[model samples]
Target: MIQVRIKPGVEDRIRGFFPWVYRPEIISYSKQPKKGDLVVVRDYSGRFLGYGYINPSTNISIRIVSFNKEEPIGEELIRKRLKDALDYRKRLSLDSNAYRLVHSEGDFLPGLIVDVYGEYAVVEFTTYGMRSFKDWVVKALVELLKPKGIYERVSDYVATIEGVEDKGGILYGDVPEEVTIWEHDLKFLVLVPRGQKTGFFLDQRRARRLIRNFVKPGDECLDLFCHTGGFALNMKRAGAKKVTAVDLSEEALKVGKKNASLNQMSDVEWLEANAFDFLRKMHAEGRRFDLVVIDPPSFAKNKASVPSALRGYKELFFRGLHVTKPGGYLVVYSCSFHIRREHLLQTLLEASKDVKRQVRIVGESIQDLDHPWMLQTPNTLYLKGIYAEVL
Candidate 1:
């Protein structure tokens, strides 16, 4: 293994359990390192910090997997981490069988994600080093969960960044294109091979269940950027007389409609169009809803995109507020790590000031319990939703 020394004062963060070491933080290396090489990181004084894998080409050059000097990075260690992650999920006792089993850094497995939908598991290896442990990961999951199948879903960007091929599809056993999973007694069709972020947004499981509280019988509801009608069906199931779901992808809308029917939910209007445009049109047409949820996809992928992401949030907040009836509920969410909880709250405050609506925040939601976050890595806490009453 290569010995990597960090610049002075950088070891304190690693000591604090922060897993990432940027390229510029390296002071010296015992040898020229290759991409995805196992390394022992050390402080300036030659004190061992952790064991990690190095990717010389990426800005985030190293992702620490084992912080204890006694523990080394290997198949056994990976299996142990997977077991721990699985144990944590088992303790969560999530209402739904579909959940995030391993949340990358949250599970101390820096570059892997595992989501379970019913009897099947979906995996994504976001880094080259993690992909190298594919056999170990799959074996551990199978032994622990006895999942009927395991599917691999790799992103093109991650593939390019890690210099790995995109081998996205079934990795083990038989995987159906669509699988029905139950959440809070409601059945949803999860498109494992095709849906976004492992079929459904399992992180929003709690928020989807929480939305029912704000809805009243015969209330009109709008679910913007509603992928697969997670919120729309819940609102209808809660007795909303009418619910409108809008999204950019017709495919998602098609699935959303199917989900509505699966739950025996009626009067849900699925609209395939840009949510921003749809919101603007609704506002222009003097449309208003008793409840509205604006759950857009991650707008800021990195720190540099934060400003534009906030602007996008502000626009959606404004439109969502404008179309929300007085005393109605409006929920807005940001899935970007760059967009913090404070950013979403501040944007809502600013939007209320401009829209001239007195808003009272009623609730705030983070990613569901299954997607556990770490204090050392704030980025692990990504999804945030603010539910407010427009007065």
Candidate 2:
């Protein structure tokens, strides 16, 4: 195996069990390593650190596979990790058919994501190192779960970030153009072939459940950025009198309508328009809702654009506050890692000031327990939500 030697004093992070080895931490290499090559890492004093897969092109030099000196990184290790992931889902009793089976680093399987929707699963191989083990992993999943279909959703941006041009697609079982799944007693229609991120936002499953608690019978609800209508359906089931769901993607709207129909919910109105534009139009038309839900897509993928993302979030919240009746409830959310709970709350405070509305925060929540956060990695705790009542 190739050897990677760390710079002096940089071995502390490795000893602390951090998975990533940054570029600046490396002092020297015993051999030129290719992408996806198995590498043995050591400290400057020649102490064994860990074993990992090397990616020379990216800033993340090594993604640790094992810290045990005698254990080997092979198909057995992959099978163990995959099995543990499956067991976790089962333990949570997460409706079985539609949920995140594996969440990359959260499950200790760095650079891999597997989302199961009914009898099908969508896999995303984000790094070259993970891509190298794709075939073995797929085989292991097939033997263990025996899902009806498996599909690859890897695309161009994933390749650009990993510094490789290889894009992955359906590698094993056949995946259909569309698939139906269930979440919290509601059936949803998903377009696996073209929908966003494994055909749904499984991370917000718990948050949608929380919305049900706030909705009341005969309440008018608005679900903004209602991709696939998860929140809308939940609100309707919670006894909301009517639901208006808005999104920019016509494809998403189509799925949203179908999902509503699948649940035998006919009181939902699906609108194919930009959420920001639709909110402004609703305000102009003197339309107000008893409960407003704002769950927009992540505006900033990194720190550089966090300010602009905050501005977008502020604008949405400001508009939602305006269209909400006095004493009505508002549920706002931000999925950007750069936007923390503090920043999100502060942004909403500023929005309230600008809109000249007084609001009382009634509740706050984050992603479900399924998406566990590493103690050292705060970025994994990305979702922030607030439930406020207009005053």
Q: Using Cα atoms with residue i matched to residue i, what is each candidate's TM-score against the true structure? A: 0.98, 0.96
lDDT digits (tens) for residues 1-391 of candidate 2: 9889999887888788778888878888899889899999999988999889988878888988788897768899989989988887888866536888888878777788888888888889888898899888899889878988888887676778887675556777788888888777988877886889778898888889889988889999999999989999999999999999999988889888888778889889998889999998988898999999999888989899998998898889888999998889989988988988888889889999998999899999888767777665566788889999988
Worst 10-residue lDDT window for candidate 1 reads 163-172
- Candidate that scores best on TM-score: 1
TM-score of 1: 0.98
42: Cα error in model 2, Å:
1.6
